[model samples]
Target chain A: MEQALYQAAILTFEELGFIFPIERPSDDECENEESTRVSVKFNGSVSGEIVLQVENTILPTIASNMLGTEEPLEDEEILQDVLGELANVICGNTLPSIAGKNEVFRLEPPRKINKLEAGEKPAAIAHLDVEESRADVLLYLN
Target chain B: MKISSRSDDILITYALGSCLGITIFDPIAKVGGLLHVMLPASIVNPAKAANNPYMFVDTGVPELFKACYKAGAKKERLVLKVAGGASLQNNEDSDQFQIGKRNFLMLRKLLWKNNVLIKAHDVGENFSRTMLLEMSTGNVILKINNETTIL
Candidate 1:
């Protein structure tokens, strides 16, 4: 499940934002103090949440890459929108593999998470190192 | 994870969706600690929990408080403030597993068992929140949608 989800996330991110993710060991010091986390919920044969955390410094690069612009965008809304869409796509693509191709799933819109407090351990956690910046993809099954 | 100086050191945690962010501070010692917890219990995945205890409230909360204590913050003089625990969009059905709500409940249960009370908090909404803890003054700040509020 973790491998499939990681593959789905990598493919979606590359195709949409032209960003690539590389695997790395988890290190608390490497986490950004100011990061953006987006969550999307899916329900069907299986129910769960997909969480994506991207550092603030990498937002402009992600937005510009997705928009095909050379200029770095400082707009928070656009940056969040791109991140949300990336999470949505990853969630949408990863569900079928988990729930079977014939099963249909409903996905809610990706929303920003200001903070994360507690719950189950992420079923799969992928560390993506992109352009000297890092992002995380976490899947939680409920 | 901890700031021990008496200066303007700040510890921040970002985008807590269903997860929770907790801040512990000692005014006398001028020390503070911040923890971001992702789940309610560590029993679900003991292996992962063993590695990343911060991913669960049950394990993370205790560890966070311990860190503060190790930093010279007395438990009796500690101020606790919390934020986060947000439900996902379009979750109108009550039967659906509400991870956010459950997370908050778990937090409350743990605090109660430990005889710790929250000094201030902003939680249980549909929006994400960022939390900041300043060691100098023991002030906890909550940010959401570009707006800031003292927690």
Candidate 2:
């Protein structure tokens, strides 16, 4: 499950956002950076959610790159929207690798989470670093 | 937040933004409580939370349940409902202060840790809300804009 999340994040970020995620990233790399969290819920053969937490520092680059713009976007919502789409795509890719392509699933629109308190354990987690920023993909199964 | 044993008492909370409005009711006891919490954790400012526990989710939730228990509400029979976590992200000057989302997350984390499940919720959006609880029937009501409905 962690591998699936990592793979999805790698593919989505590289292809769509033009950023490469570092494997086996240093845990302390992003300790002091702000993080933006987004998640997409899916229901069908299984019900659960996939979460993406990215360092806020690299969001502008990711958003602008995904939109084919060289300059950073002027709107914050656009960056949030891109993160939402990133979660959606990563979720779309993740379910298939785990559940097989035969299974059908319905995914809800992505939503941003403001803050996450102490640990609420997930089924699996993939932690990576990108552009000196950190990205974590958490999978929750219900 | 208020707890009522009176059959005709109405507990209502208004203009809930990123703040969380939690309602707990016990049908058998005819007791109900409404809680409105502004911040996620009391640790942000211990002085404020110590003075008014209702200002934060961590402190307010425990207080809400304790009060309900004192008012004769059994934890096992309590029906919990939540509302109000908004972003205010509409139009040009959108405000992305995600206090509402933070409050909702903190509430969920706290509830999950205590083995509590929310029966219903009308949460997360770009609009403000007003929540009401009827002590008579334990019906939770949500009023947004000109609309009113059961939550």
Q: What TM-score does model 1 score on chain A?
A: 0.91
Task: State the weakest 10-residue window (summed lDDT) of model 1 chain B.
Answer: B88-97
Minimum summed lDDT over a 10-residue window in model 2 chain B is located at B91-100
lDDT of 1 at B12: 85
lDDT of 2 at A59: 86
The docking category that best describes candidate 2 is: incorrect
Clashes by residue pair, model 2: B18-B100
Q: Categorize the docking of model 1.
A: incorrect
User: What local lDDT score does residue A121 receive in model 1, on the 0 to 100 scale?
Assistant: 79
Clashes per model (N, Cα, C within 3 A): 22, 1
Model 2 scores a C-alpha lDDT of: 0.83
True contacts kept of 2: 0.00
Q: Residue-wise lDDT of candidate 2 within B11-79, one digit each (tens)?
A: 999998878899999999988899999988788899999999999999999999999999889999999
